[model samples]
Target: MVSLIIFSILSLDTILNVPELKNAHYGICFLDLKNDSIIYDYNSEKLFVPASNMKIITTAASFYFLGKEFRYKTNFYLRGTIKDRKLYGDIILQGGGDPYFNLENLERFADKIISMGINEITGGLLIIDDYFTDERLPAGWSWHYLDAKYAPEISALSFNKNVVSVRMRPTNAGELANVYIYPSTGYVKLINRMTTTTNSENIIIYRKPEENTIIVDGMINIKNARDIDVAVKDPAMFAGEYLKERLNARNIKVSNPVARIRTYELFLRQKQPVLIDSVLSPNLLEIIKETNTESENLYAEILLKTLGAYRYKEGSFNAGLNAVKEFLNICRVDTQNISLWDGSGLSKHNLISPAVLIAVLKFIYNSNLYYDFYNSLPQPGKGTLKARFNGFSDTLRAKTGALQASSCLSGYIKINGQDYAFSMLFNNFVCPIKKIMQIQERIIRAFYEEMRRTNVDNTELLKPVEVIQQ
Candidate 1:
């Protein structure tokens, strides 16, 4: 039999409603999913910056509206006439906001063009990207993240996630490092000032705003292990250039040798290009796993823009948010307290209460899409949580978010065979984020230990003890 002191350790009051957490600047809401009763609540109504926790709401809308089999299609249009196996017109590449459009996909696209029996292009490649609005970066995104790999420009036709990977290694102990860029493009200029040393590797790259030049300023250890990924300025152009090179390698000559986006007004007024081929992306279930498990900001934004385009016939950020609002209204989640500016919650302007998250979670639980929705969230021993929450209850499935001093976790946990929706938010903590995560894990462990102590195996004693009283 478990010791009775477990009771002293198990009380919800001792764990959550306490003094130390009073200064934690956090909000929490726990609800019994089966009974629809509040199990624990502390300032759940108060709002705070949600960081990437906003992904939870965006994800919910994605699955609900976008469906499980949704796939983004990028169209290839030929604008020139083919005579004597030679094309004399521009090739228009159209993007539909596919988030996983990597280098492999670009190579495939290039190969498809080669297979069409066209060997030369007299005109340059013109990309039509009117599917999304003119906005590249969301409003209120901090300038610090502007140059970061995680905060690349969101575009309907972005390639390689709009990131350039640079790898540098020292030739000798005291020599300068050798640098390399993927896709072998000269669009980005790399300034190598890093010196090789036995010292620890601290080499870094900083992008100059509004410029394609990046400065490498630091000392690098001889054993440079990892590659550096930095945000690119113009994703559509970068991708176009990459495709142009691929076409050249395959013996397809692109005369201008440059890839640029077509003007929105010109694209609308120009005649439609000849349809060559269209590439369809992977299914949405896979996308959901990528978005929720890996917490991909780009995928979330793409889904948001897609939702807006589907509903309002425009892929603007405002249209996407309005579509999300419409879905929230359908779910009866009050929108009065919710303020969301970006789908990925990269912007600190996003403010949402724990109660709102819990409500949406409960609403999903009642729907037929529960299995797909449940499996999409990162479990304790899976996805982003593979290294985190190890050996913890597998029943814990949730989304994690962080930005500067703000952090959040929200999801469902099963205790004593009863499902419960929970959200925990912490803001402005000066301590290390690892410590904050430790606290969150400790609270979850407490909940698990408490449920285990009162766990009953006998069907006759299943009066639900704690639940019966409620």
Candidate 2:
């Protein structure tokens, strides 16, 4: 097993040890958790874009600052008085940076109002999105990603993940494809140029930059009802309109039906949105599960913003990023090589080294948060890695991240009851992304095989130590 590990590392060094890393960059690090010693290291300090793996840092910061049971609260306020079952005031939906606030919760809010016998609401629905300003979208996000579900607009009052569901299907085989935007509102305008075709389907969805217009022009195979979710221009508007639709369906008359989003401070220097009724998000532990396991970008980003709001009392992207940095420093993890941009790691500007990741893992392993943090990561054959690591599923627990030609996998591995943490990052790989993943899988298998032998040798006393320089 030890020979196999050496052969594996040598093999990986040859394959990954390319010329100057102009075409690709590989950062690898492995640690023996029990001994606090380096099992292997190859350019571990070299900086590389971390992609979604940055969620590890965000999640770690979250667990350290925001306890596992931390819950997000979005307050509902009736800004007006009720007269004989008639509301003479506005309905203010104050956002508390709830990332998972969905359409069902708004429906329940409407139900709660109707149950109070307020059949007629003679006021407008105002969504206070002041927790963060209009500059809610992160600075480094790509323009094209804004139209996709992966990168939604960041706001204090985000709803339905701040997405507009697109429903389309083939129409009569020759006519244009049928298209409709759900939660049907003027928040987004659709321009459909898609046509039914028998050829291979080539679908392309594009959003007008800085606008609420989307162009869905593509080819669809026959007889298919497909749904695609795209991020909306305004989350506050989306929430307001959807709530209005639900309330109207229940026969609650809204004399003013326009959806309004406000950036004004609720009352005090801080936004003092008075609570009337509210919805509490799932606890931070479960949220961290979704963020790491499913690689849910929205969950992680919201957790970052929530961290900012909780510690700094301001829920902006900058505030959250600064807070995360502060947490890393507190943990004694080196902050010099890390460049954190967005909490989700979707932004290309974020840079993190493999050694930095392992340092964080060491911190989590020694702390009381070991269990929750470990389980929060996607296990083999689970979560985002549901189809990954085919035979080694039970033995591997890790987080997978990718961005175009760049890919990464980082996490903990338990061999013969001895734990280890490792991070493998590849940047600017010219080959297919799957090829990089396959290489990662093989290297890990070697590590697993060799580590088992090392555990036995430790029990017997002398252990061989060899460091390979790339």
Give a tens-digit lDDT track for model 2, residues 1-470: 13312112444555555443457888898887889877677778889999988999999999999999998888887766788999886788878778889878998899888987998888688778777655767889987677889988887888989888888888777779988988787768999999888777778787888788989988888756789998887787778887887888899988886655554634533324455689999999999999999898888888888888888988888899989989888777677767889999899999989988898899999999989999999987889888788876666789899998789999998888888899999998787888888788888887776666654543233233443444
Q: Could you give candidate 1's per-residue lDDT for residues 238-320 as a string of tens digits?
A: 87888887888889998886655644633453555777778888889888888999898888888888889989999988899
Q: Going through the candidates in order, what is the number of backbone clashes in each?
A: 0, 1
Error of 1 at 469 (Å): 22
Cα lDDT for residue 88, candidate 1: 80
TM per prediction: 0.90, 0.91
User: Which candidate achieves the best TM-score against the true structure?
Assistant: 2
Candidate 2 displacement at residue 332 in angstroms: 2.0
Whole-model Cα lDDT of every candidate shown, in order: 0.79, 0.82
Quick one: best lDDT, which candidate? 2
Off by over 4 Å in 2: 1-23, 257-275, 458-470
Q: What is the alpha-carbon lDDT of model 1 when measured against the actual structure?
A: 0.79
Q: Which runs of model 1 end up more than 4 angstroms from their true locations? A: 1-12, 16-22, 257-272, 455-470
Deviation in Å, model 1, residue 364 alpha carbon: 0.8
